[model samples]
Target: MRGTLGIATVVLSSLMVGCGSNAELKTFTITGERIIVKMETQDRSSGVAENSSEDQLVANINAADEQEISVVITRNEGSTEEVTIASGTFTDDKIVLEGSVKQWPTPIDIYVSRGNEEPMKLHTALLDSETNPNFVLLDFESSDSEDRLILSGVSRMLGDDSDKFTISGDLSSIHDQNLSLAVAEVRITSENPKSISGLSVTELLLDDSKFLIEGIAGEPFLVAIGVSTFDYAYWGHVIVIVEPGAQIEISPSATSSSFVPGSFASPLLAKSQIDESLHRKVIESWQNSKKYLAKMDEYARAIEKAAQPITLNSDVLAVWDPYYVFKELQAIEFASLTSIAQSLEDPMASLLAMEIGALNWMEYSRKLENWYTLASVFEEDIVSRRVIPQQEALEKQLDVVTNAKTIVKGHSAPDFTLANLAGDEIALYDVLANNELVLLNFWASWCVPCIDKLPKLRELHSEYRNEGFEIVFVSIDDAYEDWKKGSEKHEVPGVNVGDLHGFLAETPVAYGVQSIPTEFLLNPSGTILDRDVTPEELESLLVDRFGDIPGSE
Candidate 1:
């Protein structure tokens, strides 16, 4: 939950002589004059999380010097061809790469065998490069693919549907004790809990009076304000949960429903048995949320130290400190308690609350779309002999506008023209002819995840290219020259495409793409698996599921 389980023990003590035998896979260190690469673990359990962490890579780093490190992963994904060297560095998300490698950057891919018979290749491109002097901020729609970028990684926020909401934002405000916000309520008609999705939340709406929330499941304090009663007439305080990305509308009062348009239906409407199981899960989650509230201070500290404001696509958004933000989000998810999580005095709590709230707007949040937007409002009144003027506060309005509307997953990926090194055009839909799968990857040359997985991507392309599988690499840079340079430097070969759309807030907005090195897989027929898939798992899935489509060529 708090990242991957494999522990990393830094060796500062010289006297503690330890053997490096894993017993399962003998690990030995190979040191060069300036680099140290450790090869361990022959058998990687597929059970490992989607992200196993590149923190302590196939190599170690000098603590004092921020040197540009490249890990070359050569994996054999059940094929005779060994996936060769591709450049990879999780820290690329940290450093700013330049020069030749910047001109022709590395692209990488993770390999997974059909079953467990073959060892999958993890290739990293090693190049003749120089020191990177910048901090990595994630330029989501960047065309450059560096060994690292500015900001990095995904936000881990989940929820459960009970007419409750959680909000996510920069919570470090709590460190300075600056965060002071009230939780909103969506009044429900019935006292029984209504089901939504993953995240947990406080019952701020339960009594119409907002109460101060505290401690998650395992924490010290635990006392209930409401009755610990169950509704036997229906199921335990449970309603059917919402679908993957659907909103659950529970009216606080039946009369209020008329104020809102359309009928409120939950995608997660389950059968009677499902409703019962969901009720149990919600209870477990509520109990868990109470316990996690104990460590609010620690999480608050992490959030405060991690936030830094930056601009993306001419839009100013606060970028939280990557490491601290990543960990704080994990704590909330694992705690499995949204309500208690929100009560946290720390800013991380608000971020969790906001994230969950956005997930279920019908029950948890107020839609920022209509209530607030880039749309301008003019309230003009004639004063005595003078006319009062009204102006559009565009930027202020845009920041608060939430674009969380239902977006269809698997149709033809929207078409957009992106350039290549030669300024040629490539449209997304043009690539989707009769192919079973198309991987639309939005990456920059500096992305640690992108660079690290390049070789594997090359391998997948080569292996499946003849088989009717298609993949395109989209760069979100403004300059085609820089894109060309990074592509050449990385030795990124194949259908490499570049989109000048800085961050297609419109395109990715149309498709709800928040994070990157994100892979989208579609059946040849293109239904919505919209499967949130990773590269390594994808390779295995393709080989196993389709097993080479008949007309694949």
Candidate 2:
């Protein structure tokens, strides 16, 4: 509800659209939590109405803090008198502007004119004789706020010739009225170059060959491959090349007169070679889904309009995969950036660039079975006479990579360092710190079932901890604060540890933990006893398997 916020009054009225050619200003009031907002208007029926007569609402960030946020609303993009209580926030202090902005049908964006506050921020940790540097994911935490925000940035030297860098982001509250207004964003987030390190930008354009090369071969520029449009189904190609200068030549290969001429068929990919293909498919998906992406944004807006009232709850949330979006978007950006480095002029520069790209791409190569490629199995020497000998390393890692079961119960747990809410250092070793009967519970906050078993777990903890029992609760949610809040909300009475990782977490692999609420019971001797056990059934089993001494809870 963007038209206003925090007015201690209430009123409602019916307004209809199409009855008039332009939107009319209707006044209303709302009351709550020591805040005041007056009146504004929108199309009666639709949430995101773009009419000339309607009031154009704008909100500026007045205050951000632990308690609450305050924003002043002005009616009409130009007029400052109209006020609307766009939305309300009683507890969490998050606010969104409701109602409609006057410049609806026209593009409402402030990006081409970027303000200082919103551009990407950067912090560097290295300096040397090196002429080039690469970007990587920078991590930071806020335990006081009980959260972690992984700030993503690029690592590359800027060129004066590079007067303008292309990136993506929307008005912070484009989705406030309804996530559906994703249509409202001036720049879509996918366009941003994340963690740019060494890229050899070649122009990406459509071409004639089945393999699209916008420019000459070896020209390495970032390319986003995927279906073009829904109705005009046909294959498309782009040209690419790599060179050693601030700018390079670029041209599109060609376009198909028919529907999608290129068959972006990921399904035909052999199961064994899925890793590489899946990575590519996800990239193509972003390109292909541009329309749906906008539709999804519209969907959010539609719901807010009451045109489609959706039940906002836990069940409805599974579709909003921030983690999936974060990784896939980053991967798409990474692959494009990686392609640039691979197209460089210097052999070593090109080699190092390609290797880095390969590392990132390969990280996601095998997670899906449909995207594998034969290029990864190459025996060619990368640089300096050293063969890219990863077969042995791959073998060692693959030895443990079993089916989904190993994601749950593997032979041995891999060790990695992560932080707890208090900034205390935590790891598998820390969780298993010199304790007998270590109880490891892998679950998440989104998982309703996991919460259901908490009481039984508490009972087991109470009964066995006095007898040297211990419990380590590991949550694999991508959002750090969400995990903390969820744990607190559930009152999880145990040693809690999480990487703030989304699904496909590295920790899960190390412990071979596949399923949520999967309980691994280890004996006093640090030997695995049962990989599959329930909280209700665990207490008795522990008592029976390992004789309990008196005074046990």
Candidate 3:
């Protein structure tokens, strides 16, 4: 049973909501003249009557940390007296307070502060001894230094049926972020779990002071919200669970003035403490993986030297090995999610894990199949809508890779026309007709490996130009300016042409140039003689064909 301590040195009566008359009651008292609240529960019942020999006030708080917090009772706007009612630490992430006052239906403010930060007001509520017997107050502050849209406030379960819940809150954005709010019925689809067209979509107007959402209880549903600043929009969602007759509140403090968006940053997203904690864990893991990758070479060398011949861990080796690190890191980073998808009781949490894991599915094909299977039971449309359709297109590209391999060594080279820097149309056959052997190089300005081979390509062109050996650079840079800048920056030799459509450029796609620094050696008749020929291999082939021609350097 819930009870309250009155302000004066007198006994007071307390009332409980949705409870029988047989419910137990406990008496509370303030030390000396100050009010001291002791709570046995996190939920607080509203007080409806004043302390006119009959009423009391009580409250309970649930927060993330066991920090020191204070409760102050104050009069309406113009009053000067502020009485410190309760001050203590949160125990087991919860704080309960019970108190009574001479006056009922009075306003009170709760202040919470951490470390050296100034005390900030966390909540304000009106209390009476007999009316308004249930209420909530919650506040949250994100430690993430990223652009975010914060929605926080109170939620109360009405009546006894547990069929419906009401959400009322203040929604604010850092960086003046623009967002939209939508509520949808979550469904299990044949291919995956998804939400159909939203049941309702509302533009989140900054001018609007507060918002409310009334949703069905018991069944799982979705609250979709996203903020867009530029061409890209970041989305965060949560599946909320409210127990019957429970009043919960969570809101962010108004102190995020310098927050800025990073390349990978999104707003602080959570519908509950669980959501917030899990999201933070995922973000930390991602950051740690990036830090490891940046020092992969250093770590690999150190570990290789430290390991003895008979004791080296293959798993550790694989994690540091340049050849295997990409796949290994992805697996290690998302391993927990795969486990969650298989066994977590909360399907909403599992769905979140699976969605994040699917972003890099191609890197871990075995995990991809498992995730897809798991998604069939709990998939979401937010990311999958973009990923699933692309799978088909990428699978087709795989077939192109196979066909491309078949055309090498003996088959005729695929012919194409593209423009050179001088604005002249250059065709493969045309270049092949002029040179005895041609190195058809497919590259992009942004490809590090392609840029690394430039000096050797220049050397080969200078040495073999007189012997009918040519290097034709087919740039797949998506823009003409990038292609021109790269070619000039590298001082490329021989003929230079650009498809200018990036990897999707007609020539590169026709030749199945999935990855770069892809090169094909073709003869005068346009028949492919080699694929992926290294500079040393090209040198030896040239020596055999030209026998160290007299003018060669």
* Per-model TM against the reference: 0.31, 0.37, 0.40
lDDT of each: 0.34, 0.38, 0.47
Q: Candidate 2: what lDDT?
A: 0.38
Give the per-residue lDDT of model 2 (tens digit) for 326-350: 3454465456545543444334333
Tens-digit lDDT track of model 3 for 1-553? 1112111111112222343345444322221111112211211244312221111122233333233333332223224434434333334333344554444334333333334534434222334443221211222122211111121222122222354434344445433333222111122221222322121113221123334433333333333333322122222222222322222222222322111222222222233333333433432334235443444433334333333243445454432343344345456556655556555565554555554543344444454554455446544553365336434444556656676767668888888888899899988899899899999998878887898898888887888888899998999888899899889988888889998866756677678787899999999998988899898899889989878766656
Where model 1 places Cα greater than 4 Å from the true spot, the runs are 1-412, 525-528, 545-553
Q: What TM-score does candidate 3 get on C-alpha atoms?
A: 0.40
lDDT of 1 by residue, 1-553 (tens): 0111111111100111132333232222211112232212223344232322222232334434443434343423233454432323334222222222122112223232222223233222112122111111111121221121110111112222232222211212112111111122212221122132222222221112112111112111111122110111001112322222222222111111111011111111112123323222432343234333333333333333332233354222222333444355445544454443333343322222322332232321222332131112212211111111101122222322332233346444455666666667876666665576777776676676777777777777777876777777876655667677767877775668766545543444444555556555655554445645666787787789557555434
lDDT for position 193 in model 1: 20
Ranking by lDDT: 3, 2, 1
* Most accurate candidate by lDDT: 3
The lowest-lDDT stretch of 10 consecutive residues in candidate 1 is: 227-236
Error of 2 at 528 (Å): 1.3
